[model samples]
Target: MADIADPRAVEVSRSATGALASLSLAMLLSSLSTSIANVALPTLSEAFSASFPAVQWVVLAYLLAITALIVSVGRLGDLVGRRLLLVAGLALFSAASLAAAVAPTLPLLIAARAAQGLGAAVMMALTIAFVGDTVAKERTGSAMGLLGTMSAIGTALGPSLGGVLIASFGWRSIFLVNAALGIAAMLAARRFLPPGEAGQDRGATRENARFDMLGTVLLALTLAAYALAMTLARGRFGGLNVALLGMAVLGAGLFLHAEGKIASPLVKPALFRDPVLAPSLAMNALVSTVMMATLVVGPFFLSRALGLSEALVGAVLSIGPVVSALCGVVAGRIVDRWGASAMVAAGLALMAVGCAALAVLPALCGVAGYAAAIVILTPGYQLFQAANNTAVTADVGKGQRGVVSGVLSLSRNLGLITGTAAMGAVFAFAVGTKDIAGAAPEAVAGGMRFTFAVAAGLVVAAVAIAAAGGLRKRRSA
Candidate 1:
């Protein structure tokens, strides 16, 4: 079971188109499941006669499962077989969706959702890795961008589609629809995706590769603890939150220690030392943090500061995803034409400008101002995403692509959590109040300005990091 000369760099084959389509659907299903369930929370609450906090687990369970096991499953795919595992994941997801649709109780539904998330973890982790195996080297950025477009579309479509389904059918219809889509995705993946190159199929890789079960357990616990601390705080940090944070810290230390001892580590400590991978991952986190700020801060600014109606507020918030969806493919082409390195720097710069615009324009204009800033910001994000993903994943070896993609995804998710909790605190602090709901319009507007000012700084920091990494590489060369 010798490795392919360059397993990760392949020419486009006849099946490449279908493989990309299967991968796109996997990305869509994973992302769509994330947001679609949010719109159903209230309905779930009423159906189960439960409190909001309890029903929130319907979302949390899915999220936590992915956060915890995404990396482990990715590494598992590397060991077992990406094609075989991803196919299994789709089947599991479809089955779990059906179980969720028919769940007789709240706890059972939550369990089903958690199982579904586990399946999604495998799909999400492997989809991007497959891009390198299927697409040509020169067109990698375009493929990454296509996946980005699918993800954005899924996120944008989830709430609207979920609402329609809930209105026409029942709360159960959403999960039922997912079941059908999952089946379709499974069939496509099985039929279209090419078999793994020489060693990647469950031959020598399976026989020789070691899955770090201990490291995986420790990481999953740590991530779960950290995620719970973030979500459960609800803007109010209590003793439980503190304890959870402590647990996360302890778990991280243990995970690191275990990783240092592993033969085939889940995440190689050396990967972060690589100039391209480290900076790209760091930028991904920093950029994601700034982006999440828009979500956390946008609703308050729109409703409180701009005095927009709820309908208007929803529409305004929708602008970001719409822009992101539209720009994803365009960004990929730019990355392909210009190269990933240049696009990464360019993307970060645009985002910085967008942040500054958000800080000032809304204070001067109105909803138009906010929309304009988002227009600038969203394209930058898409550019950064496509370029960054292409840059880091373009050169990974056959054995490491799955875990590398997983780590990339992990960084983005962590950044989202950080932005939500920490940046939200910054916004609250700027508003000069803990209860943002009660803040004056002027104060809220001021908060918007202050928050974006901070977001701009974060983007600037990302630029600096990227520049520094590039300089170091050139100096060493």
Candidate 2:
């Protein structure tokens, strides 16, 4: 390592701080865009005179685009340069937001949203990797924690902010706001960030520099087919759904086989073979699935089963996010001191307890009980995410940071899709009604309890896996 007292090191450290701020702001904006558009779905449906199912594509299309392209773009970042990719992503996101704000038809708006998702995938996949490249190794946990805090703040603010903007200035204002933020972030990044990685310029000259075009197409098709199949199977299962599912499996198999043989694979198989990396990724996916399932199912339970008004439901749900934000700051410090593995185990344990409370307490205490349970659950999620992210990134080498970040992002998207589909099916089966609105209050309550219990089981399994991995590590040591 270079001399610690060097003047250039000091200047670089100061610049890294500014770069971190820009990255954090971009993360917040990207997450805010995800949740903000959700509140406008009903308004858009009315304005476009579209059916509920059709208008739902506004959200689905964005998610699909992000999930499909994140890995491929991340690999590109490693080959070209993360700084260049990030700046381009910000510009694209800004342009897409402007396009969305002025769209004359629902289809145009949907297309713009998909474009926004593509930009978001680029920004998100590279942000953490950039931190790894720019910041000192010792301070990595603190920087990652701050990024997590910004994400929580965005998620917390989105719905309330969306509602206020829609009431005052209409739905277009949301996209307009995003456009402004994106432009500001882009300018800040260009001014503050250091030049691209040193070897990036030589990447084009390497004999193995060819991009994994086939692997990218196959992965995109695989995710799209699976997502569509799940959406189609929601209310009714039929031959088309079966065929789509088969197509998804075939696509996945081909992608994996192709990746294994490629000189420069989009996703290197060796990453999964690392003992530390493998378990961390698995826990990330499982924890995310449980977190998202609660988010989707909790509103249905509160609004339908308990007959709570929208305002009351929103207020109750807000408690968890607020707690999570506060906890995220503390969790980051803890990761630096106590280490990531311990925090992850402890956080998962808290989540399991909260899920158990939700499963059993609602019947006895009603709205107050559900609120109390979430109070436990949300902070746990925040802690686990911050710690787990730090752990997974720390284990990867600098050269492969981009691809590893992509894998983590992909795992999260898969978890979200899986949780929504799996929990929804269980809820429908428990209620004995295809239409949640038409189900009896008792049936809805039963469904909620069953879903929460299943979520608890998933968490317990994750906890067991974490414990086993810890044991194996100790024995090896």
Candidate 3:
């Protein structure tokens, strides 16, 4: 029980812990959408008679909207109130999930997914920023560990749950489940969480808190153009390939210019100048790229090569996150004893082992082979992911928490996109064909091998970066 002697301290603790629980639930719902549809993707493709490129859009659209809107929304939360943004996001997300479940056409599904992504952006941006706002500095590591644990559990369960739903009922069940969860979360948030604190300021200014609309527009264009180029590069757009490449570059340049000169930038350029933050952000991007690539590509291998069912495939894939989540608790304790840098480095080392094991999984004979590999890798991934978040936030002041959270979110999204695009291309190339439209079984296996190897290589690179650039927090003299 918290001490009631000091009313101000007690109030802050009660409010913050209550907010944390609500936000964790909201975050769980958001994460459910992230990987929940992964298992159902192939099923949806078969139902819609959609091309591979088109089906990829189902995943791409959600992530794209999240990437574009996360920074802006986080900034909005800081300017206004996290509680207000969180409740609103929950409402919007629920409505979008309902629409997604009943979507008739591919385009409608994509639009609904985008709306869901917007809701996700709101939830992710606010929850992370709220952690920095609500909790005292000394307890920050523990709060992050708990939050990270929730994320790992949500992500780990998402695919298996989606697989089970699709197997028994239908794909629509995934979205319906999200809607139910969202409604419950919304009610909880409204009942317990505080209202907008924008009017009560400790020197913060809402008068100058207009959203950087132009910066937001430019950033969206930049991300869209990049997606377009990646899609074209994969030979999706037959004739307009060169045009897509040009558009991507032009959009990138415009976004840079907008962010550089704008007073209220979509992404504050000044944050990048922080020696501690920049490398940590870059490390997150690289690390995420590796994790997402494995998630995206590894399953294809399991289903294609090992002949695993969707349910079994999701279960097998989840082993790593389960291990990672458990290890995150241990890592949090370790971070308290040592420093974030040690845990981060150790986590990356574990990830390297996992990636290597994944690459060589086919060589092993039975269930033990796969399990052994997962044991080596998953805990590492979870530990590093949590450590990175805690490390990044610890160094920044309270006022800059929202922007930092947004930047981390943006970095993560970009990494996932880049990893999927680049590695998807690499896998296609390994199979030695532009169109994997209907690849042979053996060729698919070979492609999977290539993808896993590439993922492993990326993690190894990340480990190097972490070792070379990762620095421990300094003790007070």
Candidate 4:
């Protein structure tokens, strides 16, 4: 693929709409499975008789696999053919989900989950690359907004839908549904997308086109170390903290060294040359961290503090994604008028305010106070997310799209892990010091308040990064 300064410079067929929808649907399914499983986790653990630390691996496996493979798999797509990769990914994802639906033991289940992550990586790597092929550059924001909206909807609805399914059917229903969705996406992708070579190169040198093997190993090692260290630091492995920490250091050093020498690096060092990409990536990661933390911590608060039923708790938690979806729908139009940076800054401001309000739930005026704060926060976060994605995607040419998207996606995943782990640590520390066991309502409130405040601080830092990084000069709206 050649670097077209303007993706819109090429003529796009009207039929590409079908391709976009198919691709977006695949993305939605992939994101939906993640959140759906989040709610179904407790049920799965209870049914399987798994310990908390062990069950955490179920989620961690998928995330870690996806994080590690996205960039490398994406580069593969660039080498093979986007359509071929998409079909393969969808097939793998469906097969893995079926395996997950039938697994009888923890190891089988974990293996199945890891397979799903690999499938997801393929799907993720190819989906966005296909988007670049299907849509015009000028309309990328709008198209990405549609994708973002669908993702938000899937994310928001996943938990409630999973809860209902778990209540009516068994926990396996979640994986079964993913299989069904995957099958559907596979069929749709074949029918709608034109068959072609996915990762073809028209360039001069084979050396430049070779996969960044060292970089891939480094990336995998880096994420593994981080995940392992977090697990150890949580005291899951009573004596492995020092070893885990050492692994983290070693992995970081290897990743940096590999990134520098690779001709076709997973993370192109040139991306950092753009003043905006680095900070934008930071903001993306931090915001996701906050979102994940809140998502994880909120359930405990609603269940233990407010005494809400699981169904009601899911409904309340769903509000943000719902609003965020709506905001994403509108954000594209807003970005067209206001520019990407303004939208980003505004969205961050909204998230900050929303987080602050949620952090102070104990001080709310009435029963509806928490709900209102959620409504406020969700829309902003979603809008900011959509705008930020569009900006990052547009920052580079077609050749760089997959890699950029992969790294950006990786950052967000890392953020989610960090936020969840850190907040869990905070809540655990708070509860450990409390007089009551299982945490009193007041103690729950205090813990949540502290976490939300910390989340708010992170968002504020994102805002400052956006402002200080010369974004104002670029987006003058």
TM-scores of the candidates in the order shown:
0.95, 0.94, 0.84, 0.87
Q: CA lDDT of each candidate?
A: 0.91, 0.85, 0.75, 0.77
Mind giving the per-residue lDDT tens digits that candidate 1 earns over 1-477?
997765443444547888999999999999999889999999999999999999999999998999899998888888777899899999999999999999999999999999999999999899988888888899999999999999999999999999999999999999999999999999999988987842242222455467788889899999999999988967888999999999999999888887777566777778878989999889999999999999999999999998999989988988988888898999999999999999999999999999999999998989999999999999999999999999999888888888888999988988998898988999999999989999999999999999999999999999999999889989999
Instruction: Using TM-score, give the best candidate's number.
Output: 1
Query: RMSD, model 4, all Cα superposed?
Result: 5.2
Better structure of 2 and 3 per TM-score: 2
Model 3 lDDT at residue 443: 83
Stretches > 4 Å off in candidate 1: 1-13, 197-208
Question: Which 10-residue window of candidate 3 scores lowest in summed lDDT?
Answer: 468-477
lDDT (10s digit) by residue, model 2, range 310-397 = 8988888887777777777777877788888898898899899999999988878998899889888887777788778888888576
Report the Cα lDDT for candidate 2.
Answer: 0.85
- By lDDT, the best candidate is 1
Ranking by TM-score: 1, 2, 4, 3
Per-residue error for 209 in candidate 2, Å, reads: 2.9
Question: 177-276, model 4: which lDDT tens digit per residue?
Answer: 9999999999889977877654434332555777778888887877877766665545243457557668778987877777777566666666666676
Model 2 regions lying over 4 Å from their true place: 1-13, 198-205
RMSD of each: 4.6, 3.1, 4.1, 5.2
Model 3 stretches astray by more than 4 angstroms: 1-15, 39-58, 102-106, 163-173, 194-196, 199-207, 231-242, 303-312, 361-367, 431-453, 468-477
Q: Tens digit of lDDT per residue, candidate 3, span 56-140?
A: 7787788778887888787777666777888899999999999999999989998999999999899888777776666666666
**Which of the two, 1 or 3, has more TM-score?**
1
